[model samples]
Target: MGLLKGIDPILTADLLWVLRAMGHGDRLAIVDCNFPAAQVAKSTVTGKDPIILTVPLPQAVSAICELLPLDYFEESSVFYMAPQDGVAMPPEGNAVIDELKSAIATVSSPDVSIAPVERFQFYEEAKKCFAIVQTLERRPYGNAILVKGVIGPDGKDLKPN
Candidate 1:
């Protein structure tokens, strides 16, 4: 088995798919363990409609957010999500969240608003994105939707963080 340097191993397949689907202005959604990804993501490459994936949600997200070259996407559309309930963001994702925010911000098209969606709203948004990865993470309200923005053709190349 091979690996993408710096990306968590748990992200392999989903991250690969994310890198493949997203281009400038495209989007990827990372939902909680309980979130339903199969219902939202683009049809699988294998042509299987009910394919189930098992992995850590945030790690998968962070992996793609951490490594892929930013040659064909937007910066302003990149976002992180958490339940809009009054509680603080899930503790387990704090470091991952922080790292993801910093990494995406370095991009020129990063989303200006890192908005948090209410539980039900997040579900609806998932249906609209390019794909969603249902994580094994059980943290409450652990959801993030990263809108793909164009990677400037004239911008400098990116290295894994």
Candidate 2:
């Protein structure tokens, strides 16, 4: 039997496959319900097929973070969609960002910081990711992008098991 801790029940098998298929430096976008995921995903630079999830924004992002190690090579591996109208981060946006930071800290380092990108720029960035998860979150700025990192070896026995 295979058992993995910290795996959220909302992570479906398709989502798991997407995670496993992603390599170091690959990016994953978790967007809100209003995001044009289907249109954007069709044109990513990644040659692989894109995966989209329709759960809540926070749940999808947190669940993905639980299993996906973040890429620390970049200054800020996480990015949020900024409002095109130059508005402030709403309470919901702040809550989602905080939740993502807390979740990333559990699996990786505590210094993970999320940057912001303009609305159109965010869509372009999403077009380069390996996959995009479209959540049911109706909030305007609930989108986020995560870069994947490599997992270390199982042990240092100096031989294969």
Candidate 3:
């Protein structure tokens, strides 16, 4: 077990390494069980298998957000998979995303935007991520991409000089 204090126990060594190694602007995909993680992971920056975590989507996202600084440079640093119908978010998806938004607000700015990408487009975006973390969430569309940001020299979020 990691001896690091205040770190979430859910963040295993492999996950911690991935989170720490990713540079600013690099993306990390947290997808549901139904996502094609292996196929998408092969094309990711790490070019490796997905890191499987036995937790629900909200739990996984909360843990990751605790340590991962979201990109403030981009217009929308976080992205979720939009529903196929494109009219409204499914109830399950809405619940998950609402939780995600609250989790992110704690780490980053309260105003940090979480955009939605079409299903296929999200897969394409996931491929470009540095790594993928597949959670044991059974609900559909419980998938998101988090862009890594850096801590400034002052120990705060990086911003324009």
Instruction: Score each candidate by Cα lDDT.
Output: 0.55, 0.76, 0.88
Tell me, by TM-score, which candidate is best.
3
lDDT by residue (tens digit), candidate 2, 42-123: 8765444445566767778777877887776677888888767757778887777676667666655677767888888999
lDDT of 3 by residue, 85-135 (tens): 536677988888887788788766787889989888899999999999999
Instruction: Flag regions of model 3 displaced more than 4 Å.
Output: 85-88
Clashing pairs in 3: none
Candidates 2 and 3 compared: the better one by lDDT is: 3
- Clashes per candidate, residues 3 or more apart or on different chains: 19, 0, 0
lDDT, model 3, position 54 = 93
Q: For residue 143, what is the lDDT in candidate 1?
A: 65
User: What order do you get sorting by lDDT, best first?
Assistant: 3, 2, 1
Model 1 residue 1 CA deviation (Å) reads: 3.6
**Candidate 1 overall Cα lDDT vs. reference?**
0.55
Give candidate 3's error at residue 95 in angstroms: 1.3
Q: Top model by lDDT, which number? A: 3
